[model samples]
Target: MVKVSFSSALAQKEVKKDAESLLPGEKDPEVGVPLRQPSRAWCWCMCLGLALMLSGVVVGGAYLYRYYIVEEGRVFVCGVKYREEDYIIREEEEVQLPSHFQLRKLEESIRILEREQVALINVPVPEFQDSDPADIVHDFHRRLTAYLDLSLNKCYVIPLNTSVVMLPTDLVQLLDNIRMGTYLPQSYLIHEEMVVTEQLQHVEQLGYFIHSLCQGKDTYRLQRRDRILGMQKREALNCHKIRHFESNVVVETLICEP
Candidate 1:
């Protein structure tokens, strides 16, 4: 730094002499074009160049905004969220797409089921019976879930309007309570008795469960089995061959033989 400063100081003398030689009254100087302010045309040209550059920048920005921003998400869709049915893959967004083959297969099954009119009844009820609407449907849905759990590796809700016909045990229980004696139980509604399709055998089992639960152990027949069933009993009967035509599961009568 000190050496640079000393060199600059020595050069200042020559610079001062050059300045003195360029004064108005100076003579015997090397002739050259005199130093002057920039020409008006040059100034105008510079201003025009800057204006054109700024305009070009604005036009390029407008074109990019229109192409990228305005053209996004131009597809129609429906579902929980208002998203495009056909989504564009984006760097910032993550999406888990459904398997096309699996989805198509499932849809095909549903369509086939839908085409087959509602399942044929298992048995004829002379008159419609009154029961808790919620309990019956929920129990049936739950029964189907348990039945599917073993055979099916994946879980999905099967869409159907399920109506299961069951034997009335509530009335029998009331009668037993009034008479102060244990009543003998009857066998549950089985698939053989109903007009059920090959697809709906588990639903028949569901009917059996409903009827058995309605018995409520008021009869001597049910007491021993329920006591025996103990903690192992479940609302659903998990059958491996539920849809198989060859297998038959007749749920035991809760009541003892009279």
Candidate 2:
């Protein structure tokens, strides 16, 4: 009888334990420990990895931006010793020539056209070992153009009527492609011979661009032999030449003085 009573009490205790577990406040001991929340250090580590990846992406993007601008020639920066304003030309002149002096068309790749009474000449930067890459640019019909000397950090300007030309559409596209390293055109070499008919006495009257060019040198006004021969005969003159290159054209300007 005692054994039966003890068994009945043990079964009752088991039933009570199961009922306690079924209640919301109690957990069954057999279910094992509840899962723990992530540690603070682990969460921080994950955040750091994500932050590093984001920073890497930003840095890579910046590097690519700089590379394209430089390689594509969108931004041209000169040396620290150079100033931008010193090379600017504020003065310009326009001299009318007689219609009899006709400029011959050089070739298919080059054309000398007059737009709004301005003469478009195919002139380029004088070649020098120290000379940096430069570009010529102007707004069409602006009558003013600039020769940007990247090495010297100079922007020389001349009036269109004075044999300076604005950037043509074809040449502009070609230069862009060259800068981007996409295409290269065959370069043509040409020469222009000019005789110095008159020494420049009034340097002040000359444009700032030309004045800068003639600085420290005896400069003279140049004229073609064909034009001078038609007008009058002249003696042989002392001569010097400047070799220049731009885009696909190389020009040798021979300047002579009596």
Q: Where is model 1 more than 4 Å wrong at Cα?
A: 1-27, 30-33, 74-258
1-258 per-residue lDDT for model 2 (tens digits): 455335888899999988887899676668887789999999999999999999999999887864443223222111111111212222363434345543321211122222322222323333334223444433345544334344444344433323423245544454446554432333334555666566556554554334444354554555665566653345566555443433344444445556
The collision pairs in model 1 are 122-194, 122-195, 185-255, 221-254, 221-255, 221-256, 222-254
TM-score of 2: 0.35
Q: Report clash pairs, candidate 2.
A: none
